[model samples]
Target: AQSVSQHNHHVILSEAASLELGCNYSYGGTVNLFWYVQYPGQHLQLLLKYFSGDPLVKGIKGFEAEFIKSKFSFNLRKPSVQWSDTAEYFCAVMPGYSSASKIIFGSGTRLSIRP
Candidate 1:
């Protein structure tokens, strides 16, 4: 079965700290990767996504991810984080071959940034 893994369950950092949340998947075929953030009491918002074309894709809020096929990794990174970046971040994967493929989400990583 295909699945996603987020190594960090919770990450706490002060403002301006560099952030990198690990994400890996166990799929053998083509896949699309996504990073979604859900702020406190808010709906999930798309942070970044990687489908085709580029291995490195940038998303909203100065966030980006690199899709490394050799490692089955789609790690999210931000040079510096803010207190407002506090939220639950999820790493998701969907098979690219199928239009109806259900997205598999990792056990979220909760980010807490101190002001």
Candidate 2:
């Protein structure tokens, strides 16, 4: 089945440190891209997205990512991350193949921030 994968199962970072996450997917056609971040006990928020048009997209909380169509990859990056930025991150893709189609989530990267 088509799916997204988060290479990092866990990440540890100090305050004001850099963060780079690996994301990949297996799909045959057009799709929508997204990165969702879930803070402790908090709802998931859109970190970034790639619909159509440009391959590069910016997201909230000072996050950015580049979509490589050929590689079937969309990796999230942050030059410097805060303690609050530490959370589980997931990558999803909507193939638009079905109205009932659901977004597939990566296993998630549980990020920890240290002071």
RMSD of each: 0.8, 1.2
Q: After superposition, how far is residue 29 of candidate 1 from its true place, in Å?
A: 0.3
Write one digit per residue (lDDT tens) for candidate 1, span 1-115.
9999999999999999999999999999999999999999999988988989889999999999999999999999999999999999999999887889699999999999999
What TM-score, to 2 decimals, does candidate 1 have?
A: 0.97
CA lDDT, candidate 2, residue 85: 84
Q: Tens-digit lDDT track for model 2 on 1-115?
A: 8899898899999988888899999997988889998999999888888988888898887899999989999999999989888789999988867777588888999999897
The 10-residue segment of model 1 with minimum total lDDT is 95-104
Q: Residue 46 in model 2: shift from native, Å?
A: 2.0
TM-score of model 2 vs. true structure: 0.93
lDDT of 1 at 16: 95
Model 2 CA lDDT for position 72: 96
Top model number, lDDT: 1
Taken over the whole model, the C-alpha lDDT of each candidate is 0.95, 0.89
For candidate 2, the per-residue lDDT at 28 reads 78
